[model samples]
Target: MLNAVIIGCGGRGQIFAEYAKQYPNEMRVFAIAEKRDYLREKMKKEYDIDDKYIFSDYHDLFEKGKIGDVIFIATQDNQHIEPALMALSAGYKNLMVEKPIDRDLKKCILLSKKAKEYGAKLQICHSLRFAPFYRKMKELIDTGVIGEVKHINQTEGVGYFHQAHSYVRGDWANEDKSSPMILAKCCHDMDLLVYLTGSHTARVSSYGLGGFFSEKNAPEGSSARCIDCKISDKCPYNAVRIYEERPNTTGRGAVEKEGFSNLEDAMRKGRYGRCVFRCDNDVVDHQVSNIMFENGATANLTMTAFTKDCNRVTRVMGTYGEIVGSFNDFEIYVKPFLGNDKKYEVEKIESGHGGADTVVVADFLASARGEKEMCTPIDISIESHAMCEAAEISRRTGKSIEIADIMSDKEGALL
Candidate 1:
C-alpha cells in the first residue's frame, strides 16, 4: 500500500484522508502535521496513525525525514508555498496541493521550479477537472460536438449563505489576509475555462466592487455580535441561527472542529459570530471578467455572492454547435447549427464538490503509484493563476491587462 502524509487536517485535508478509509489497499495516512491539537488528535484516531509520526508543525515533520511517498498540502490560501518547497527539498517524491498554488506569482513560480528541480510529481487539487460533469463536457468538446470554440460564458453563484460564511465572515473574508475573490474563489472557474478551451488566456479586463457587506450596509442598531444584536432573529446572516441552530449542516470547519454541541460556545467567542455587514471584509460580493484566449476564442466569467447556493453554470458556443449546462443538475445540452439537440445526464455520486473530491484523491493515489499521469500538473495550473492575477490587476487599474504582463518579472521581462 502507498503511504501518505497530510500537512493540514482541516476539511479538505480530512477529505483526502477519507480516501484511505475507502481504499485501504491503495493508500493510507502514515503521518500528519497539524497545529491544532484537536484536529491532529482527531486525524490520528481516525486513521490509526502512530504517535511518533504526528507533528504539531510541518517543519518538525519534515525534520523527521521522509515519512511517506506523497505529501498532501491542504493548508489555507497563503500557507501552501513554504510547506511545498520544504517537502520537495526533504525528498518527498509525490505531492497533492490545493489550488492557486500561491497567492503571490513569484512564489508560485519558485515552487514550480523547485518541484521540477527535484523531479517531484505534483498535482494541484483542481478537483473540478476530475468531476464527471466537467469531464463529460471535455469529452464532448474533444469530439467536435461543439466544432471550433468561439466564445464561452461561465457563472459561479456563490450562494448567499456560503458567501457570508466563506468570504464575508470566515477566514477568507479579507483580500489582504487571503487573496482576491478571483484568485481565492474563482480560480477554479478560470482554470475550467482554460481546460475546456485548451488555450492560454491572452488578456483580461475585469470589473468588481464590494457594494454589500460593508459597515455602511449594516442593519440599523445592529450589535457587533449576533447574540447581542436585537435583529438577530430576523437577520438572514444571523451568526447564531447559522452556527447554533443548524451547526451540523451550515458550519463548515466548525462542524468538524467545534462539533454541533459546542457551536454556540465557539460562535460566541469566534470570528464566525461577527455581523456580516459590520465585519472588516473587503472582498467583492460580485465581479465579472472578459478574457481573450490565444486561439482567438473569447470567454466571460461572472462571480456573485447574491445568488442561491448552487453549482456553476456554463455555456459554450462554437462554429457548429453550442453547449449549456449547470453543475447543480449534472446535465448538459448540446445543439448543433443544423440538426436536433442532444442532452446528456451524469450519474449522481454522493461526494463533495460534485463528486470531484473522491475522484481527485483516486487520481492522486494512482499517480503516486506511477500508474497514471497527474491530470492537473503544476505547469498547467499556473496558467489559470496568472489569469486570476491579471484579472485582479485589471479590476484595480480600470484597464485591461495582458496575461503576459502579470507573468513577467519586475523589469517587465517575460519569464
Candidate 2:
C-alpha cells in the first residue's frame, strides 16, 4: 500500500486521507502535521500513527525527512508554498497540494519550476477535473462532437447561504488572509476551462462588485451577530439556523481549526456567527471574467452568490454545434447543428464534492506508485493559477491583463 503524510489535517487534508480508509489496500495515512493540537491528535488516533509521526508544526515533519510515498499539502491558500518547498527539499518526490496553489503569481510559477528542478511529481488538487460530471463533458468534447472548442460561457452559482458562510464569515472572507474570490472559489472552473479548450489563457478582463457583502449592505435589523440580530428569524443567512437549527454546516466553521473555535459559544462571539453583511469580508459577491485563449478560443466565466442552489451552469460553443449543462442536475446536453440532441446524466455520488475528492486521491496514489501518469501536473496547475491572477489584476485595475506578463515561463500555450 502507498503511504501518505497529511499536512494541515483540516477539512481538505482529512478528506484526502479518507481515501486510505475507503481502500486501505491501495493506500494508508502514515503521518500528519497540523497546527491544531486537537487535529493532530485526532489524525494520530484515526490513522493509528505513532506519536513520533505526529507534529504540531509541519517543520518538524519535514525535518524528519521523507516519511511516505507522497505528501498531501492541504494548508490554507497562502500557506501551501512553504510546506511544499519544505517537502521537496526533504526529498519527498511526490505531492498533491490543494488548489489556488498560491495567490502570488511568481511563486506559483516558481514552485512548478522548483518541482521540475527536483525531478518531483507535483499535482494540484483541482478535484472537479476528476468529477464524473466534468469527465463526461471532457470525453464528449474530446470526441469532436462539438467540433473545435471556440467559446465557453460558464456561471458558478455560489448559493446565498453558501456565499454567506464561506466568503462572508469564514476563513476565505478576506483577500489579505486568503485569496480573491475568483482564485479561491473559481480556480477550479478556470483550470477546467483551460483543460476544455486544451489551451492556456492568453489574456483576461474581469469585473466584480467587491463591496456588495459589506456593512453598507446590511439590513436594517441586522446586528453584528445572528444571536443578537433582531432579524435573525427572518434573515436567510442566520448563523444559528445554518450551524445549529438546521445543522447544515457547509462553511460555518465545520472545521474548528478553520476558526469557528467553539460551536456552542460561536453563535454569539465567533467569526461564523457574525452577520454576513457586517463581517470584514472583501471578496466579491459577483464577478465576471472575459478570457482569450492562446489557440483563438474565447470564454466567459461568471460567479455570483445570489443563486438558490450552489452549482455550475456551462455552455460550450463549437464550430459544428454547442453543448450545455447544469451541475445541479448532474447532467449535460449535446445539441448539434444537424444531429439529434443527446442528454447525459450522472448518477448522484456518495463521496464528497460529487466523489471528486476521493477520486483525486485515488488518481494521485496511482500516479505516485508509477502506475499512471499524473493528471493535473504542476505546469498545467500554474497555467490555471496565472489565469486567475491576471483576472484579479484586471478586476482591480480595469485593464486587460496578459498571462505572458504574469508568467515569465512560456510553457504550454504561453509561448
For all candidates in order, the CA lDDT equals: 0.86, 0.85
Runs in model 1 lying further than 4 Å from the true structure? 244-252, 255-261, 410-415
Lowest-scoring 10 consecutive residues by lDDT in candidate 2? 246-255
Query: What lDDT tens digits, residue by residue, belong to model 2 across residues 1-415?
Result: 9888999888788888888888999888988889988788778888899888888989988888999888999998989999999999999899999988999767777788889999999999998888888888889999999899999999999888888888988878888999998999999899999988888888999999877777787899688888888888888888777766435346334436445556657676667778888888888999999999999999999999989888889899999998898876888899999979999988666676666888898888899889999889988878778888888889889999988877765353333
Alpha-carbon RMSD of each model: 2.0, 2.6
| Backbone steric clashes in candidate 2, count | 0
The deviation in Å at residue 310 for candidate 1 is 3.5
Residue 377 lDDT in candidate 1: 88
**Candidate 2 colliding pairs:** none
TM-score of each: 0.95, 0.94
